[model samples]
Target: MGRFRPGAETDRFGIRIAASGNGVHVTLCRPGRRPCIWLHLATAGTVADKATVDDRPEIAALARRAPRLEARALECVRNDRVLFHDLDAALEPGQVLQVEGPNGCGKTSLLRILCGLSLPGAGEVYWGDAPLPEVRAEYYEALAYVGHRHGVKGELTPIENLRFHRALAGGTPDRVPGDALAHLGLEGFEDVPCRTLSEGQRRRVALARLLMTRRPLWILDEPLTALDRSGVAVVEGLIRDHARSGGMVMITTHQAIRLEGCVLGRLRLGG
Candidate 1:
């Protein structure tokens, strides 16, 4: 929920507020320091109407305590063939689940099921101690999904795409759009349209969103697909830091990647 009023500016604690038709954007700042997240206020009517991830019990518990993602008896069927049959897994804070298998092994399907992009044929997914549906919207706030498609707009520059994702997620909690692009090794290529960038560059643009938000759960599918050695190293390093700092990352990679200081878990989907 929002703590500031729109248009009528509130500087009680150096909070900057601006109003739009139905939503509000706020920048919380400290003396001589960069502003924090540009928060999204769901509505302009009342503070109670402003939706925040913490306004819900499920998300609040997740943030306040150790977060875990659990999948029980997850099953995926295709044309009467069982891809995943009664599959089960659990992911905790500071952990990485690397879904590994050969092609056509339903690795993507399992990850999709975990990310709520697809439903399981049999069991359920739990966030913290509650079912996913109990905290669906808030769960999304804490989740960052990067699929095989790269999720980039062909006509948009890397910076534009990153900024677009930032807006979608409410704000850039860490690096700004430009800095995130630069950090992902897309410095001079920031202004180039994705259509012109190499395969690896486009993947980097998609990954730049990771720096834009501080979501705890990362669902990445084949993040190493278009990366060169250096790019792969960068991605590995990001994954390591995320887990080390108590964030959870679920990745699908066929390449050999060693994550330092993480409790690694593996799942074979079609086995």
Candidate 2:
């Protein structure tokens, strides 16, 4: 709805079109009524008005798919000591990599570096042979980072939290809240305030965002910290589906997760 304008058209479909910052906008025009009907269509990659109705669905489908991850490390130094000396790792499409180590190790730090939220002290992170800084925006557009803290606000309901996250991330919240809550087994409590929910339920809300975003790379720090068996299964299934859809995942957790057909690698940080 940001900066949109309507226009008349004489095309075969007899439908008027609108222009918006998000993407192409479509509207139906009648003889007398002043543009009684309107529809807004947004696509992630490109914009086009000539697309058919069927094409719109296809574009939406593509947007739900995840992108690939290509992170490499050149070197890393911290406190005059080498943290990751010439660390170089590449995760192919549809693969999952785990960073395992004891507490106080650099697992979280490395994840932050990969996410480009923090720069490595003396190393280079890359997204397909290109430095992360050069493509930081692109990385942000393609990645979703879930840190130790569940990012849900206590005052907001589960649905409201997800809606806020989707809006901030530039994603359509039309189905995100519903889909995420349902997937995380919070359908009945979707409207309940997060503060009223148990710790596990709060974690569920954060985990639900994984299904809603189109981001490919998921960097989770202790993603399963406060979940029961069922909750863990839900997250595990989501991870499998994410990898199957050509997405990349980097996780740091004490719990062991086993997935077939998933290439697993580990980085032991501390002694």
Residue 34 of model 2, lDDT score: 62
Question: How well is each residue in 79-185 modelled by candidate 2, as lDDT tens digits?
Answer: 77666655666766567888888876678778878888777776677775578888887678667889887698999999889888887777333255887789888
User: lDDT: which candidate is best?
Assistant: 1
Prediction 2 TM-score vs. true: 0.71
Positional deviation of residue 138's Cα in model 2 after best superposition, in angstroms:
1.1
Name the regions of candidate 1 deviating beyond 4 angstroms: 1-64
Question: Each prediction's Cα RMSD?
Answer: 10.4, 10.5
lDDT of each: 0.77, 0.69
> How much is 171 displaced in model 2, in angstroms?
3.7
lDDT tens digits by residue: candidate 1, 147-258: 9987899999998898889888873356788888877888899888899999989999899899898787899999999799999989999999777656789999989997
Q: TM-score of every model?
A: 0.76, 0.71
